[model samples]
Target chain A: MTDLLRTPLYGLHLELGGKMVPFTGYDMPVQFAGIMAEHQHTREKAGLFDVSHMGQVILRAESYQAVAGAFERLVPMNVLGLGEGRQRYGLFTNEQGGVLDDLMFANRGDHLFVVVNAACKEADIARMRAALEPDISVTYIEDRALLALQGPAAVDVLAAINPAAGEMKFMDVATLDLNGAQCWVSRSGYTGEDGYEISVPADQAVDLARALLAHDDVMPIGLGARDSLRLEAGLCLYGHDMDEDTLPAEAGLVWAIQKARRAGGEREGGFPGAQAVLEQIASGAARKRVGLRPEGRAPMREGVELFATSEGGEAIGKITSGGFGPTVGGPVAMGYVPVDLAKADTTVFGELRGKRMPLSVTSLPFVAANFKR
Target chain B: MKYTEEHEWLLPEGDLIVVGITAHAAEQLGDVVFVELPEVGTEVTKDEDVVVIESVKAASDILAPLDGEIVEVNEALTENPGLVNEDATGGGWFFKMKVSDAAPMDDYMDEAAYNKFIG
Candidate 1:
């Protein structure tokens, strides 16, 4: 508590009656009005999130092609083929075919812009510097603050200030002006909502956030709502959902690996763990992540062991991320299970305390995504 | 009304003492999503965890304030758990217990003392 860092909007959060809690060494707002209220507000309206804790980086080389080519060596995604002004989800893999970290990278024409999880930022920066340094410089953008304006009304709220926001399609990244601040805006977010993530100068972050929050439809959302929103969206939370030992195939993230980087595509097998990852892709992983819907109202939170039978049997899997999904109106969870039990409608059991409660294997995105095409 | 260190409030009425969490406890717990009440006829001892209360953030237990037998529990909590957040002291009451010995109620703190204890 003594050494925890604070975002530029830390004071603003307290001013709005936010409950501050420690998150990844930073003191962040866990909730403002209330978790349930803020969550419902974000789904019904617009939510302003201070994501300044996340790492923003710039990877620059002589050309975008050079940087993309260098970055392609570390990730499984098709980085070299990424179009300028567009962003794509990516992952860094290890030699064991496990994921290092999941991130979003945008081809900014002049350089590539990367946003990584706050917990993995330091290691990610070190990894990039070691792998693509000197020739391709990895610059951590510390002077900027990131804010995500999410939900259905997020577009109109942001567009009212910068009309260009309305023109941007999902995954589009561009440099736009918002309330006199030059911001790197992306039409993508973790919440599966049609929204924009704006990167602004640290000094101007508070003003821009205040400007967006001034709209009647916009409310200040904290990390608590942010987690619930993403959980309902079927999005993975880095360390909880996938980690250094979890393969992309097992985590069900193979779709992000474009055809060009797969087994027989244009640039086949250059990334770390390409062999193991491709092998799993060709056949199938032993265990796979699946959506779990507990039959009862009680949430089967993270670390709750799952069983094959309701009453007995050895632990088959473990819930990775679980909580009451506000929009789903019930408990939603994600966990790994044997491939046979990973399919939707399969009946599984989660052990709550001493009882084995029934849970149905379900399709993800407990609530449908509201992303704009 | 008497209060315990756990933030539970007890209001004596005849032989039964109504039990519920204070507004401060409810507020700290955030939004209550589910409540698992003990059986009405179950005998309870002081400090025994009886009610299982789950909010969006975490799960907590409501302990028995004194040795008693649970006579009645508010069934409304099963359908609308938010009642605990709306009116913790009134409609949000957990259960009514007939105390085996009402003398222990004297050791509990009053409203003013409980308020100071929280501070």
Candidate 2:
């Protein structure tokens, strides 16, 4: 096994008696107090996550607009309309319009800040470098650490440290002085809740994390709860729900692609697989992503085969991510199936442990999102 | 009472041996949420996976310490499963089994030795 990477807050995690496990090549805490408690705490109160392992990349150029235009050509998003101090969730696709990774892009005052998943950071950087215009430069901010403070009480707790933070709306960004340290705070998160993603200097990460935990409503949450929380919120985990073989259209992320990028548009940004993506968008994709609600208490996990009732019970899809949604109080799953079977309220079957469990194809996001917007 | 190296404890109860996870194992597992016990009369061999336990984070297998036929299971665990987390070595007793052979008893460590082994 490869040696696990340590984050800036590794010592703090150890000090808190965190149970460390290998996650995305990093020694991350799977739980602290307990998984169910931590998961519930985040939903009811607030939870601090040491997400320093996520990669931070700075897109620099002479002007912000120039870099934004160049970035729009690479990813399928409305970057041109993004104002200063705003962040947008988007995806980087391959030649076949398949998503390489999903990431958050923020238009900082001078540079564009991009956060990619830790496991796919290296590949995402390479793709950005290859796709970015010659004049636009890209720099990986490895010296920085990312922290996420999420839950219902996130706003109140975060405001205690950074007073101005409460003013930022969802997807908005602001460079603030956090306890005398320069930090970029974004009103966004992976969990379907109102939260903030803070990028701080590597040295001061532990200090900020400590201050956040000092609040009564804030507690240290681990990767275990984080996965369940995101899963309950119906968020797509990169490697689990999306990969190079999965197209954004099929992944139910067509909204991320701006109308201008569609076929027969007056303005066109020549990104990879534009022809295929536009065709899929115009005619509707063959297969589409859908949420599944399995009938029983047993959690349906990844790799389980999905059978289509419409196709005479023929297996047509497979689960990409599945688990017990703590907040939803049942089992929820996401998978790709034929377009006809991907409609909401459609009945399907998931073969779990040799038994065919009845499932319903529902709309994306099993639970209501609590984003600040 | 004796303990296996894998941190399972076996208590002598008449002709049957009561089995449960050790305190050390429960502490390591954090919080127990669900327990999957084998059916009564199921035959099991030493070191065989006879029961499965799930915590909020991950699932774990409970290995049988001796060859036996399952006689009784802790049905209470199905509801108040947290018993395993609160008192793993005591009230968390998973099942009772009639020993098929007494030879494997020699492999189990005594309380003092098992404590030292865990430490």
Candidate 3:
């Protein structure tokens, strides 16, 4: 605990009565009001999140095409084709067709701005430096703090501070001035809502967060609500849902790999695990990540064994991430199941405390995405 | 009110004792989302897991404080689990039970001792 790092908003979190907990070596706020209330608040109005723990990096080179082409070798995404001022989700794949880490990268004109998960930031940065450095500069933006303001009312609240924010569409990134601070703003978020993730200077983060929170529609949301919101949105948490051994196709993240990166496309079979990933893309994966709705109110949390039958002979798979989804008003979960049982409305059993409970296999995103697109 | 080390509170009422979690336990558990209660008239042993309470963060088992038969269970918690977080002591009581031994009640902590123990 003594060695835990504190974010830029640590003092502000304590002032706001946030329950601080150790998350990825950082003493972060797990909740302020409560998980359930914060969850509902973000869905209805706006919620401000202090996400400074995530690593922000800038890759620079002679030109945008040069940097994009270098980055395309590490991941299976069409980085070259990504439009300027647009963000795309990407995965850093290993040689075994597994994900090392998942990230969001945007083409910031002359350079690329990337954000990776807190738990994997160090390794991700090291990997990027080793792979792309000397040619394309990988600079970790440690002086900035990232804040995500998300919900249906996010645009209205942010537009009041910076009217230009309203003009940006989903996934569009721009440099905006908020409260005298030049912020790297993106009209996107992890909650599947129309919102913005503002990267502000560390010193100005509190002012920006306070300014946003001053709005009646915007509340201070902690990591607890953030996790629930992402889960309800069917977004995968880096380590929880996919890891070093989890393949993109198996984790339902093949969509992130554009057609150009697939077989027969212009730039195909050049990524780390292109052979296996392309094979899975063409032939289909044996197992798939599917949404699970527990029959009862009890949440079938991670590590709970899943079976094909109530009286099963052997466990088929296990839940990756699961908990009470506040927006759904019940337990929602995601886990790997055989492709045969991954169909919607299919019934599977999760063994909880020695009893087999039925769970219905459903499509992703229990709550519909409210993105402005 | 007699309190157990597990953060359970027992209120003596004739042959039956009203059982519920303390406010400290409720706060520790965060927002209670689901509560699974044992059936009425079910026999329970001391230190045995009787009720299952799940908050948004995690799930925890409420151990039986004394050897008893569950005379009545809190049905309201089944509909709205937040009642436990709202009123943990009064209307949020978990169940009423008839214990086989009243001697154990004296061994448990009193209000003062429980507060000190939590502190």
User: Which model is ahead, 1 or 2, in terms of lDDT?
Assistant: 1
User: Per-model C-alpha lDDT, please?
Assistant: 0.93, 0.86, 0.94
Best by DockQ: 3
Candidate 3 Cα errors over 4 Å, as ranges: none
Scanning candidate 1 chain B in windows of ten residues, the lowest lDDT window is: B8-17
Ranking by lDDT: 3, 1, 2
Off by over 4 Å in 1: none
**Taking the tens digit of each residue's C-alpha lDDT, what string does model 3 give over A1-373?**
3699988889999999999999999999999999999999999999999999999999999999999999999999999999999999999999988999999999989999999999999999999999997999999999999999999999999999989999999999999999999999999999977899999999999998899999999899999899889999999998889998889999999889999999989999798988988898889999999999999999889999999998947888899999999989999999999999999999999998889999999999999999998
Estimate, for each residue in B1-119, the C-alpha lDDT of model 3 and write its tens digit. Answer: 99999999999998899999999999999999999999998999999999999999999999999999999999999899999999999888999999879899999999999999999
Q: How well does candidate 1 score on lDDT at residue A77?
A: 92
Clashing pairs in 3: none
Error of 1 at B100 (Å): 0.9
> lDDT, candidate 3, residue A362?
95
